[model samples]
Target: MRQEKLKYLAKLALLVLMGIFGSFLISEAGLRLMNISYPVFHGFDPVRGRILEPGMEGWFRYEGNAYVKINSAGFRDVEHPLQKPKGTYRILLLGDSYTEARQVSLENTFGRKVEQQLQSCERLLPHLVEVINFGVPGYGNAEELITLRSRGWAYDPDLVLTMFFSGNDLIDNFPRAELREPAYIPRPYFHLDQGELKLAYNFQEWSPPILKYRLLLWGVHNFRTLELLNQANRVLAARHIGDSQENLSSRAGLADFVYAPPQTPIHREAWDITEGILKLMHQEVLKHGANFFLVTATSPDQIDQEERILLKERLATKKLDYPEQRLRALGEIEGFPVLNLLYDFQQYAEQHPAHLHGFSNTKLGAGHWNEQGHELAAQLISKRICQDPSIL
Candidate 1:
C-alpha cells in the first residue's frame, strides 16, 4: 500500500511541473503573436557612461508604439561601413534622446530624412549621401564630445552636426557635487580645470553587475513574459523610491532656469562647461578636416503659448529665448554655423495648429518629436544645406 501511494504522488508532481511549463510556453507565444514586448536597450558603458545594447530589437510602448532595432554598432540607425565609400559624402549626428528618436521608426527619423533629401540635391547627385546617427538618450555635450573622439571619427564623416537640446543639455553637461533631488543616472561629466577640459567618470562605481545583468538581459531579450515582469518591477521600484524625494523626473523646474541667465553657481558653471565643450567639439571637428554646425532643437514649451505664459508668470520675465541667443552668439563668435528652429517651429505651429513634438499615444504637445516634426525639421535642414551648395 505504501509503495502504491509513493508512485501516485510522484506522478502528481510530474504532472504539475509539466502543466507549469506548458502554461509558460503558451503565454510566451501569445505575447509574441500580439507583438507585445518590453526590453531595456541602454546599459552602462564604462567609456561613454551608457550606450544602447547592440543588436537589440523590441517594441517600444512607453511613449510611442514602434519597433526599434539597434544596429550591430549600437546605434538606432542602419549600419554603414567604418571606412567611407568612395564618392560618398558622410554626415555624423551627435545628440541626446531627440536624435536617438526611439519614438519613431529609423526611416522616419530626421537624420534619415535629411539623407534622403540631400541625396537628390543637384550638386550632390554624383556623390552618394550617408548620415550616421550617434545619438544616445540622456547624453549631454560632454558625452557627445567623447562620442565623436572615441567612436565617431572612425566613420570618416565630411561634416559633423550636433543637435543641441536647450531643454536639458545645459544641466546634463556638468557634474554637481550633490543634488537636492534624485540623480537618475550617472554619466561622465566635463569640467574646466585651470581653463582646460577634464572628464569625470563619476558613474564608474555604478556599473552594472556583469553576470547577473547579462542573465537578466538574456531573459528579457528571449522571453516577452519576462520583459513585462521586468518593466512592472521597475515601475514599482520607482514609485517606492519616488515617494520620499522631490519628483525630479519632470523638467518643469529646470526648464525655466535655462531661459534666464544663470541664477545659482551650479547653473553658471553649467553654462561655462557647456560653452567650453562646444568650443572643444568645434575645434576637434576642424582638426579632423570636417565642418561643424550646431542646430538648436525647439523645446515644447517654446511652442506652446499657454505653457509659455505660465512659465513667464513663474519667472516674471518678458524674454525667454536667452539660451538660443547664447548658442547663436557662441557659434558666431567661434566661427561655426548655428541654426535656431524655435522661430520657424513656432511659426509653423501657429499656422498649421498641430503638435510636432508629441505623439497621439502620449500627450499631444509634451514629449519627443512626432512624424510631422521630423518631416518639417528634415525639410528645413535640407533647404538650409542646399541654399549654400558649398556647405555640401
Candidate 2:
C-alpha cells in the first residue's frame, strides 16, 4: 500500500510540473504576439544619464497604456536619417517631458504639429521642415547640451530650439539626492569648476548595483510580466514608505526649489550651473552655423489663473516672472532669441478657457499640453519662425 501511494504521488508531481511549463509557454507567446514586450528599459549613460533603451518597441502602460517604440537611435520619435537632404530645413528641438510629449500621440506632439504648420506655409513648402526631437523626459540643461553635442550636431540642422520648462528644469540642472533617489535613474551631474563645466557623478557605473544587478535590470526591463510585477512592487513599497503617489513617480517640476526663493545657497548654485550649460550650448550651435532659439515653455500652473494662485501661495510669492526674465537675460547674454511663451499661454488661456478641458491629464490629473494646447504652441512657433527674416 505504501509503494502504491508513492508511485501515485510521483505521477501527480510530474503532471503539475508539465502544467506549469505549458502555462509559461502560453503567457510568453501571448505577450510576444501582442507586441507587448516587457520592461521598456532605460539605459544609464555615464555622460547624459538615462536614455530610452534603444530599439525597444512596447506598450508603456503608465500613461494610458501608451504605445512607445524607442527608435534604434534611442529617441522617442521616428527614425531620422543622419544625412541632411538638400533643401531640407532641419530643426533640432531639445527639452524634457514637455518636449518628449509622451502625453499625446506623435501627430499631436508640438514638434510634429510645428512641422505640420510649417508645411502649410507656401514659402516654406519648397523646403522640408524636419524637426528632430531630442527631448528626453527628466532631462535638464546639461543633458540636453550633451545630447546636442553627441548626435544633434550631426543632423546639420538649420535651427536648434532648446525649449525650457521653467517649472522643474532649475532643479534638474543639478543633482540632489531627494530629487533623484525616488526616480532611480542615474543622471550625470555637472558643476562649474573654475567657470568651466565639470562632471560630478560622472556615470551610472559608479553605482555598483547597476552592474551587480545587471541581470535583474535586464529581466525587469525586457520581460513584461516581470515589469508589471515590478510596478506593483514599487507601488507597495511607496505605500509602505508613506510616500505619496506623486512623490514616488513624479519627475522634478512644480514644487521647484530653484524658483521658490529664499534663494538659498543651493538654489543660487543651481542657477550658475544652468547659465554655464546654456552658454556652452549656444556657442556649440553657433559653431555649426545654425540659429538657436530659446523657447520658455510654461506649465499649466503658470497659465491657469486658479492654479497660478495656488502655486504662488505654495511658493509664498506674489508672482514669479523670475524664470522668464532669467531666460530672456540668457538670450541677451548668449545671443539667442528667447521666445518667452508666458504671454502667449496666458492670452490663449483667457480667450479659450474651455481648452483647459483638453489639457486634462491621462494619469493622476497631471495636466500637460492636450491636442488644443499643442495646436496653439505649434501655430505660435511656426508664426515666429516664419517672421524671422533670416531662417525661413
Candidate 3:
C-alpha cells in the first residue's frame, strides 16, 4: 500500500512539471513567431537617455490599436529634411504622446492635420508650411527642452509649438517626485541651485537594481505575464507606500498627490519649479530664432463642466484647478502666448454632445484625445497661425 501511494504521488508531480514546461515552451514560441512585441520599443541613448529606436515598426496598444513607425531621425513622423525646403515655412511641434499621436494614423494626427489645413491659407501665408512632429511618449518639460536645444534647431523652425499637459508634467519635472511607472525608467530634471540650472540624476544609475529586477524590467516591458505581476505589485506597494502625513515631503508623497490636483498646497513648489523650466525653454527657442508658442493641453478632467463634475464627485472636492492657469501666467511673463484650449474645447463639447474630444483614461475614448479632438485642435491652431503675422 505504501509503494502504491508513492507511485501515485510521483505521477502527480510529473504531470504538474510537464504542464509548467509546456506552457513555457508555448509562450516562448508565441513570442518568437508571432512578433508579439511590447506596445512600444526603445533603445538606450547616451544623450537622449532612451529614444524610440529609429526605423522601428511595432504595435502601439494605447488610446487605440495602431502600428507605429519611426523615422530614421528617431521621430514618429515621416522623413523630413534637415534643411528646410526653399520657400517652405517649417514648424516644429513638440510635446508628449498627444503630439507624437501614434493613437491615430499618419494623416489623422493633429500635426498632420495642421499641415493639411494650412493649404487653405496659401493666399494668406504664401509659403508652404511643414510641421515636423518631435513628440515622444512620457516626455516631461525637461525632456522637451533637451530635444528643442539638441535637435529642434537643426530643422530651422520658423515656429516651435510645445504642448504642455497639465496632468502630471508638474510632477514629472520635479526630480524628487516618485514615478510608479511599470518599468521605473529614469527621467532627467534640473535643479535650481542658487538660481542656476544644475543637472540632476544619472540615467544608468537612476534605478540600480539586482539581476532579477534587471531581467524583470525587460520582461515587464516586453511580455504580458510580467506586466501583470508588476501592476499587481504596484497595487500592493501603493497600499503600503501611499502618501502619509509623515512622508509628505518625500518624492513618493509628492507624486501621490496626482489624485489631489495641482491646487493642493503640496504641489506649490513643483509648479514654481516648472515655471522656471518654461522660462528656460523660452530662452532656448529664442536662441534658435524660432517663435515659441505654448499650448496648454488641458487634461480630460478639466475640459468640460461634466468632466469637472466627475472629478468633484470622485474626489469630493470643490477645487480642482490645474497648473494651466499658472502656466499661462508664466507664458505671459516669459513673452510666449499660451494657447488656452479650454474655452474652445468646452464649446465643442456643448455643440457636439455625441462626439468626444478625449477619453477618460486608457479606454478607446477615455484617456487621450479622440479623432475629433485632434481635428478641433488643428482647426483652432491653424486658424490662429494663418491670421497671426507675428508668430512666424
Candidate 4:
C-alpha cells in the first residue's frame, strides 16, 4: 500500500510540471508572434533618466522604450535635467498626445514654436523666455498637473500652459479606466486630505513583486492590446462609414479625417472630465506659484464645419453614431483666456488652400500640428501672453 501511494504522488507531480512547461511554451510563442516593441507602457521606466537620440521619421526602439521619431527643423532633446536658469522667465507646457507631437517632428511642435516666438520677443522685452515641453502621450490633465508639481516645479517656471484636447483627455483621466498600459502610464491623482495633498502611489513602500506584476501587465495588455484594438476599431468604423478600399488606402490623405461622431451621450463624458481636470490643473499650477494658461486645441471638424457635417450625414445614413456640437461647447466656457486655434486654422486654410495636403501634411490628423499649424498657434499664444501680462 505504501509503494502504491508513492507512485501516485510522483504521477501528480509530473503532471503539474508538464502543465507549467506547456503554459510557458504558449506564452513564449505568443510573444514571438506578436513582435511587440518598446515603450510598451509608461512607468516601465518611471525615472526619466534615459534619453532617445534623434532619428528618422519612423518608429525606433531606444533603451527598451519605443518612440516615434521626427526630423523637425530645429528640435533637440534637453539632455540635462530641468533646472532653474538664472535671469530667465521659464514657461512649462504640458498636455497629452497632441502636445507630445505624435505625428510631427520636434522642431515643428508648438513647444518649439512657442520657444522661438519667445526668443524673438526677448529682443523687444528685457526679460528672456524659455519654454519647455513636458508633454507625454496618452496623459490626461491629472498627469500633466502631477508632472508639473513633481518634476516640473524644480525648473522654476513662471507660467504653466496646459493645452486641453477636448476629445479624449477626460476619458483618459477616469479612475480605474485611466490606468493605461505600460507604454502610457497614467499619472496618479491626489485627493486633498487633512489640508494637505498626499502622493497618490506609495512607490517607495510598495512590494517589488506587486509593482513588477502591475508594470508587466500594463506593458503587455495596455500598450499592446489596446493599440491593436484601436486599429481594429478604426478599421471597423471606416467600414461602417462605407469607405472604399481606395479611400481607406488614402486615409493618410485625410489626415484631417474624422469618423462619424458617436451619437451616444456616453461619449460626452470627455467634457465633464476635462473641466474637472482643468480645475485640478489650475490648483496645482497655483500651488507652484505659476500661472496657468489653457489653450483649446482644435478638432478637424471645427476647422471644416460643413465638410464634417456632410460626413456626419453620410455616416448617419449608414446608421453609425458620432459626436456633435455638445463636444464643441465644452471649450466655450469663460474661465480662462482660451486660444481658439480651430477658427484660426480655418481662416488660414481658406487663405492657403494648398496647405490641406495628405495625412503627412494636414493639421487635422488626430490633433497633431503641422509646421504651419504650430507657427500659427505660437503666434496666437504669444499675442495672448503679451495681452495679459498678469498671466506671466
Tens-digit lDDT track for model 3 on 296-316? Answer: 775677655666787777667
Where does candidate 2 have its weakest 10-residue lDDT segment? Answer: 356-365
Backbone clash pairs for candidate 2 read: 38-223, 38-224, 39-221
Which is better, 3 or 4, measured by lDDT?
3
Clashes of each: 0, 3, 6, 19
Against the true structure, candidate 3 has what lDDT?
0.71
Cα deviation at 238, candidate 2, in Å, is 6.9
Provide the TM-score for each candidate, comma-separated.
0.85, 0.83, 0.78, 0.60
Q: Return the top candidate by lDDT.
A: 1
Candidate 3 segments exceeding 4 Å error: 1-37, 122-124, 179-183, 205-266, 310-322, 355-365
Estimate, for each residue in 1-392, the C-alpha lDDT of model 2 and write its tens digit: 99999999999999999998887777667777876554645666656667777877665545533556678788888989999999898999999878877767777889998987887677677898888889888888888988888878888989999999876677678656355454355666678778788866533665675664455668777666666667778657756653452462244332444345435666677788888888888888888899888888877777778777887887788776778888788887767788888788788778874553233224222456666777778888898887776455
Clashing pairs for predicted structure model 3, backbone only: 359-365, 359-366, 359-367, 360-366, 361-366, 361-367
Winning model by TM-score: 1
Ten residues in sequence with the least summed lDDT for candidate 4: 47-56
Candidate 1 at residue 374, lDDT?
A: 86
Estimate, for each residue in 151-201, the C-alpha lDDT of model 4 and write its tens digit.
777778888888866545544544333222232332454433453444354
Per-residue error (Å), model 2, residue 114: 0.8
Ranking by TM-score: 1, 2, 3, 4
Model 1: how far residue 30 lies from native, Å: 5.5
